[model samples]
Target: MHPCLEQADILELIFKEIYYRPTGSHTEKDLLALALTCQRFKEPALDTLWDTQLTFGPLIKTLGISDAEKESENDAFDRDVRVILTNDSYEPSPEALRRFSSYARRIRRISHVPDARSSILEEMNTELAVLVKLSSWVRSETPGPMFPNLQHLGFIGTLSWTSIPCLIILLESKITTFSMYWGNLDPKESEVLIGLLGRLGLSIEFLELTPLSYIRTPIDPNKPSIFSEMPFPITLSWIIPLLKELRSLSCGSISLNQLALQNLASRCTFYKLQSANTSDDLLEAISDPTADILSPFATLQHLELFEDNFRDFIKLVDYMQPLALQTLILHHTAPPTASTLADLLHSFSEGQHIASLRQFSIKHTVSEFETINSVNMDIVFDGLTLSPLLSFPNLLIVEIDTPCGFDLRDADIRAMAKAWPQLRRLQLGSKIGWGLPPSVTLVGISELLIHCPRLEDFVVPFGARTDPPPITNSTPIKKNMTYLYVGNGRAPGDGSEQMALARFLKHVFPDLCGVGGEWMYEYGLEEEQLDWAAVISLIKTQC
Candidate 1:
């Protein structure tokens, strides 16, 4: 009797520990083993065992079935579990179907009874009967809400068109997020599902659709059609009105026709539209007036445009100005003419457009340095003044990278530092034909310390073959410097120039906390071997 009492106490401790463990740590099999251990362990272990999110396909295949024996077995399994069959490749054995149906029915019973709070069934690719069975169980057996805490649902592969209307009816009021991939739903069927969500006044915050390869081809361009006239299996137009409550949206690569873009933009506030290996037809769609219906992205704070072919920045500038945006990023190489730069800057600077601009980034792609070498660096420096007009008096970050041709001059550096007195972070990169003059290098660093007294980060990449000149300033180094990055190539005079740079940094910028080493290849040193830590430490100690 004393030994029995001790065993009961040990069992109680194990039960308490299991109850406090986080939900995702254990699998159903593990919990089942614990349940079989003793009567004391059975009840608590069963509780954790049944509260599960189960996926059925991989589990079924893992048990094994021959290809030739699958069809009858699958049919038998479908009847018992109510799984609707869609794809031709899958065929489960009768015994395997029986096992699946038993387990699914058990899960349903456990979820619907008085105690369970949350459950999930994901990636269902089964037949219609199985879905109907599950939905009917939820509707009839569950007491208050079918799935009171059900928050996520995912579908992969196709479902029979007939099964969708029933599935939509069951899911309309419960799920908050739904995702489907590689599935085909005919327009009429899709409309029915949309109508169900509309009738329920459901609020779905996220929606994603990934089209199968066969479904991605555009309808014959030679024919005239409305979106409804297209022969494709899916039309998002029917669901657009219900999508107004969404805060985030991601759609797989699809050709955007004017009607589709207009409908989507009108519904969603934050949007990302991406197309890879684009065609001429899509480009034409963007240039058309209908595209503007989505324009200025009035409530959009972040925007990314890819695979674009507009000749100039004028269109984007005109379209985006009214949004009063905060962040802008432009990719792909565009010819940077002085007029083009001035005009682009003027658009953002004038009026109330982008008055809240805090971060701006422009990335150019060009192999030969000569293409970018043609632009006058002075004009580029002057163009930066355009920011103050937008009330960005304290521009915090700027990144400028262009291929080759322009060199930094002393006057260019002075004008930029003077123009944005409160600038705190700056990154500049120049390709082949561009190198900063020694005077420009010294004055630029000097002017940065003077005008932007609060500056904490600096990255300057010099692609020239000349040595940087010494700083002529008599003022002491400021203690505010915290991070620095410098990438320099081999200069003509070699070690002497490197030594000069080391001394200037050590004496002039004594408080430097971090440094990115110069990469000078000719000194028998690998690019990565440059002693950045040593330099920064030395500067901090000296200051």
Candidate 2:
């Protein structure tokens, strides 16, 4: 290749890397600037700039089509074959309208018809008419052959359920991923849209619905109660039918009534279900009578049930009779009981022929302080029958987010070590409070590190109150421990506490890879001194 071309190629590659960085990375702005330095850089940079997903109002403003012309044709088309109009709200500006109109004229899909009378302004108006005409054309178009390569189509702002029917009629055959947020469609209307989706011949692999909120009271408190009480409509229940074809489905605050879930299970072989707020009513809806609610997930690989009713979780486990479940996630909630927790584990072992379960995460809600403090350390560590099951011998990760005060004994840790020989990651939450003895904190952690020999990552809140006895080298630690996270809290021995902890780590495990912690403001160490670099370096080594 010529040297000039090679130089251009290098610049293009650099530009692509910078453009793809996560939104807030420090290098993003600088990279964008470098890409605009010359013509070769300009083309790729502009391509990246236009690669953005476009919204409807912005398109209208960008194209500069007049409202009169838009009203006349009712069809809008774009020359960029890859471009898709997102129905998100965008306030249009005059310049945007002209740009879009100019781009629209080059596309073959928009046909121009001449009238006997010709005027420049009228010709511009006619061009606008063509754009609007395209929009209407899309509405009436049948589903057989439009947009064959389209992967995603998102609806942004409020749109009536009826409008969605048009969408279904147009692109249903080609689109595989669909997402909608905060639309005006009521539950009944939403159901209609879902039903329409079920009839589409194409397979939709992913579906996401934004949370819907209805106003119960007007802001004017003094106005005569204008809001007449109508029997609140039954919760919207439309998506059940379409669930059958979905590989993935996510919704906000879904009410899993029995019928809805049964419908979902019968029709859809869903591999994943993510929900924000799940009620017992909904849990009861989907649970199998004889198995854990999770049991029916024969094909399910990933499940995220965030901070739901604990009872529902129990019911879920009861229904989730052993299947091929691999990953289980429980966020912002405490385990209901040792028995319940055991049952969940047992279900995974007995119900499913799982070769290896990858992750088990439980993040306790902040309010569960007492529960965390009161956790029966023995049951969690030693009392439970986890060892005999030996079901998750290949388990890779376990995470628990809870308040401080719960204490784990050395024997309990040893039991876990015996059960999960190949465990790789463990994340636990710790809060410092007045009630617990300092010795209890240090010993529990020391015991855990000593037990899990293959463990690689350990995250715990740091800075527990200073007690007379500091963590010593009595217990042996696993040499492979590589990542450590210490949360912010009070630490003993001033700034030296961190160094002391590091010393303890080095002494107990000479192969110590990383050290980092959250120290209380009172500790007087600047935030910059938190040893994050050391921690990162350690993690890199382990990886």
Best by lDDT, which number? 2
lDDT of 2 at 34: 73
Off by over 4 Å in 2: 1-147, 153-173, 179-202, 209-236, 276-296, 306-320, 331-335, 338-348, 365-390, 409-425, 430-457, 461-490, 494-543
Write the residue-wise lDDT of candidate 2 on 376-433 in tens digits: 2333322353342455666678665544333434354556666666778766544322
Off by over 4 Å in 1: 1-242, 248-257, 267-296, 307-312, 319-321, 365-394, 410-425, 430-439, 449-457, 462-484, 487-500, 503-543
lDDT tens digits, residue span 1-543, model 1:
112113446677876677668987777676666767777654454334433444332223322342313355444343333322334444455555444433333232111111111122233334333444444434444333433444555555444455554456436445556555523554454444445544443566665555212223332223322336434333343345556666444344334445544554454365443322232333344456745654534565544333234334455545444656555554445435545555666666663543466655555544322233333344343324333333455466665554323445546566666766777776655422234332345446776667777667665543223444455655437666655555442333344444555566666666555544333312444533344444444445533
Residue 3 error, candidate 1, Å? 36
lDDT of 2 at 72: 31
Say which candidate scores most in TM-score. Answer: 2
Q: Which ten residues in a row have the lowest lDDT in candidate 2?
A: 214-223
